[model samples]
Structures are given as structure tokens and as C-alpha cells.
Target: MYVVIFRARIRQLDEDYRRSAERLRELALGRYGCLAFHALSEGEEEIALSYWPDEAAIRAWNNDPEHRQAQQLGRERWYAWHRVEVAQIERAYGAAP
Candidate 1:
């Protein structure tokens, strides 16, 4: 498994941003082979973590037209700064309570 970490300094968020975010999450999970998606925000900062099966899926998702539009909108309106990092999972260990 691989993980994409997205960190952003938020500029502003409106209804469009909310709707777009929901749609993109659905699109990523349903069409792009996203294994899981999680996100949170605090103050003016946001972080999202999405798990993927491979680099190809990630590349495909990145190139999707709607996603591209969202990226542009993010750059123009929603985010002040953002960074994305992709990393491979080496091992897994977890506990459930």
C-alpha cells in the first residue's frame, strides 16, 4: 500500500469547497482505486491522508479532469499553500479497541 499525504494552509473555505471536496473523495474512492481516505482541519491548517494500491492509481487520479479542475480551484481560491507527499508502506501493525 502507498499513502498520499496532503497538507495545506487554508485561505478560505466555502460551500463550493465543501461540495467539491465531498465529490472528489467519492470520485477517488469509487473510480481511482483509493483504498481509504481521511482528513481533518484545525484552525487554518488541513491534512488529508489517502491510501492507494500503487503509483499508477495515484497518477491516474492526479490526471483526472475533475480533479485537475479542483486543483486549479484550490490554487486560486481555497488554499494559501499546500504540499503533497507520496510514500510506500513498508510494514503494518495496528490495534483496534
Candidate 2:
């Protein structure tokens, strides 16, 4: 498994940003083999972590047209600054109830 970490300093968020975010999450999980996705925001900062099977899936998702459009919109409107980091998961552990 691999994880993409997205950190952003938010500029503004509106209805269109919300809609686009939801749609993109669905599209990623349904079509791009995203294993899991999570995001959170505090004050003007946001962070998102998305899990993927491999680098190819990540690459495909990165090149998606709708995602590209969203990225552009993010640059223009929604985010003041953002950074994305991709890393391979060496191991994972959890407790189950």
C-alpha cells in the first residue's frame, strides 16, 4: 500500500469546492483504485490522506482530467498553498474490537 499526504493552507471554501471534493473522492475510489481516503480541516489548514495500491494508480489519478481541473481551481480559488507527498507503507498495525 501507498499513501498520498496532501496538506493545504486554505484560502476559501464554497459550495463548488464541497461538491467538487465529494465528486473527486467518489471518482478516485470508484475508478482509480483508491483504497481509502480521509480529510480534515482546522482553521485555515487542511490535510488529506488517501491510500492507493501502487504508484501506477496514483499516477493515473494524478493525470485524470477532472482532477486536473480541480487542481487548477484549487490553485486559482480554494487554496493559498498546498503540498503533496507520496510514500510507500512499510507496515501497518491496528487494534480491533
Candidate 3:
């Protein structure tokens, strides 16, 4: 499995940002083989995590046109700073909810 982690310091997030964020999540899951996604925000910082089957799936999502546009918007409007990391998962464990 692969994981993409995004940490950002927010600048502004309006309705357009919200809509596009949701759309991007849907696209990632429905078309890009994204296994799961989670996000949290506190104060002006946000962290988003997305899991994928492999690096190729992650790469495909990263290069998606809509995603590219969103990234550009984030850099120009919604975020003051951001960092992204991709990692391969060796193992994972969790208890049932």
C-alpha cells in the first residue's frame, strides 16, 4: 500500500475550495484507486492522508488534470504553505470500530 500525506497552513477556504476538495476526494476514490482518505484541521493547519494500492495509483492521481488544477488553486489561494509526502506501507493494523 501507499500513502500520501499533505500538511498545509491555510490561507483561505471559501465555498469553491470546499466544493473542489469534495470533488477531488470523489475523483480519487472513484477513478484513481484510492483506498481511503482522511483529513483534519486545527486552527490554520490541515492534514490530509490518502491511501492507495501502490505507487502507480498515487502517481496517476497526482498527475490528474483536475487534481493539478486544485493544487494550483491551493498554492495561489487556499494555502499559505504545504508539504506532501508519499510512503509505502509495510504493514497496518487497527481495531474494529
10-77: candidate 2 lDDT, tens digit per residue? 99999999999999999999999999999999999999999999999999999999999999999999
lDDT of 3 by residue, 1-97 (tens): 9899999999999999999999999999999999999999999999999999988898899999999999999999999999999999997889943
- TM-score: model 1 vs. ground truth: 0.97
Query: Which residue segments of model 3 deviate by more than 4 Å?
Result: none
How would the candidate models be sorted by TM-score, starting from the highest?
2, 1, 3
Residues forming the 10-long window of minimal summed lDDT in candidate 1:
88-97
Q: Which segments of model 1 are wrong by more than 4 Å?
A: none
Error of 1 at 84 (Å): 0.4
lDDT of 2: 0.98
Please say which candidate is ahead in TM-score: 2 or 3. 2
Which residue pairs show backbone clashes in model 1?
none
Model 1, position 4: C-alpha lDDT score: 100
